[model samples]
Target: MENLSTIERILAAKQSLPGALLPILHDIQDALGYIPPDAVPSIARALNLSRAEVHGVITYYHYFRQTPPGRHVVRVCRAEACQSVGCEALATHVQSALACEFHATSADGDLTLEAVYCLGHCAVGPNIQIDETTLHARMTPEKFDRLLAELRSKP
Candidate 1:
């Protein structure tokens, strides 16, 4: 976990939109790798929402993480289109290669795997987004492994 003071800095941003919980959550997650439990009260106070309301919002979003993430987050598309193109097998191969289950991080703490509903690249099918960049069309297991190796090589 990052220092709680970091979260306090984020809360001070006052970035939430009226009646829009998602943007606030996104900003928080973007600033901090994950949402800290202590943020619930702070967010509630800032947004003029109840603690339960803030907590509910956090729990409702699958994009939110309660724990720190690995240095890189790998999201594999698992929507119907991606699955139709063999994403399941690709996902299984990635899990096996990394020795980490979905939503789990590698032992080296370099990668975290997650399943995403879609990347809006169905035409490419079986797309993957590594961190903020989307890799379109070519998400074969072999390619994924190579990409991982490339990411590992970086300092």
Candidate 2:
């Protein structure tokens, strides 16, 4: 299958590195968009790690997704700093607007919502990182709607 071949290629490419598990996993996710459950066994075998070990690593990191992401990813800060600035309400608004919870892709597959501890913009708490860039500061329900509208309008 395509997934198997991609996983094999990733394993071969990164197996030679020191502390290769993390890099391999990251590469796998990067290449496939998500680390499919089936890839776990292959990864474990290539690295001589147990399935449990591989699964543990995947689940341990909030960034590693087992399912593919949507066209866009929205990460709302959940750290104490963001919380103090009303991130809780912001998060609720995001989930309600997207109709998806943290780590879930929207039904239309246009967006994925996730909860991140911080985006390094704590001073501007309630910030969100859209995709890999485009950090929105001082987020509120109204601003979030505009952002979502822009994302939806994108190709």
Candidate 3:
């Protein structure tokens, strides 16, 4: 399958280096949107690790997803600081707006919503990051709508 070849190519390129697991996983996810579940065995074998170890690493990192992801991802911080500043309220607004739950993608495949522990913007809590690239802090329902509109505008 295509996925197998991709895994092989990545392994060929990165398996020789020390600490290769994370980088290999990242590359696979970057290329394929998510780490395919079947990738575990190949990855484990290449790195001479147990499947449990590979799977553990994947599950331990919230950033590594095991399923196919939506076209866009929205991560809302739920850290203590963010919560103290109404991240819950913002999360509620995001859920309502997207009609999607955390750890799930929108019905139309428009976006995936997830709760992240932190984005390191404690000074401006209630931060939300779009597609892991854009960080918006001090979020309000109104701001969320605007951002959603901006996302919809993109191809």
Candidate 4:
């Protein structure tokens, strides 16, 4: 299958590097969105590690996902700065509106909600990043709806 081919290529490309495990994992995730469960054995064999080791690395990192993400990834800042500015209420609204909890993709697969520690925009606090780009600062429930509507309106 194409996935296997891609994984093989990724492994071959990064296998020779020093301390290659993390880079290999990162590359795999970049190419496949998430490391497939089946990938653990192959990676472990290639790197001379145990499947448990590979899986442990993948599971230890918050950035690594075990499944494909939705069309959009919405990350709301939950760090102290943002919380001080009422990110909790904003978070509640997002969860309610999206009908999915943090780290989950919506049933419709249109959105993935995540809790991020910070967006480095504390001055504007209550920030949310959409799809790794487009940071919206000083967010409110109303702003979120309008933004969601705008995204949904796009073909």
Q: How many backbone clashes does candidate 2 have?
A: 0
lDDT of 4: 0.91
- Give the candidate number with the greatest lDDT: 3
lDDT per residue (tens digit) for residues 1-155 in model 2: 99899999988999989899999988888888889999999989998999999999999987899988999889999999999999999899999999988888999999999888878888988899988778889999999999899989989
Q: What are the models' TM-scores?
A: 0.88, 0.92, 0.91, 0.94
Better of 2 and 3 by lDDT: 3
| lDDT (tens digit, per residue) of candidate 4 on 22-129 | 998888888887888988888998999999998998999998998999888899999999999999999999999999999999898999999999889999989999
- Give the runs in model 3 whose Cα sits over 4 Å from its true position: none
Rank candidates by TM-score, best first.
4, 2, 3, 1
Q: Which segments of candidate 2 are over 4 A away from where they belong?
A: none
Best by TM-score: 4
Tens-digit lDDT track for model 1 on 1-155? 46456656666665455665677677778888888788788778877889999888788888899888999999999999999999999999999988999989999999999999989999888899988775757689988888989999999
RMSD of each: 2.1, 1.4, 1.5, 1.2
TM-score of 3: 0.91
Shift of residue 112 alpha carbon in model 1, Å: 0.7
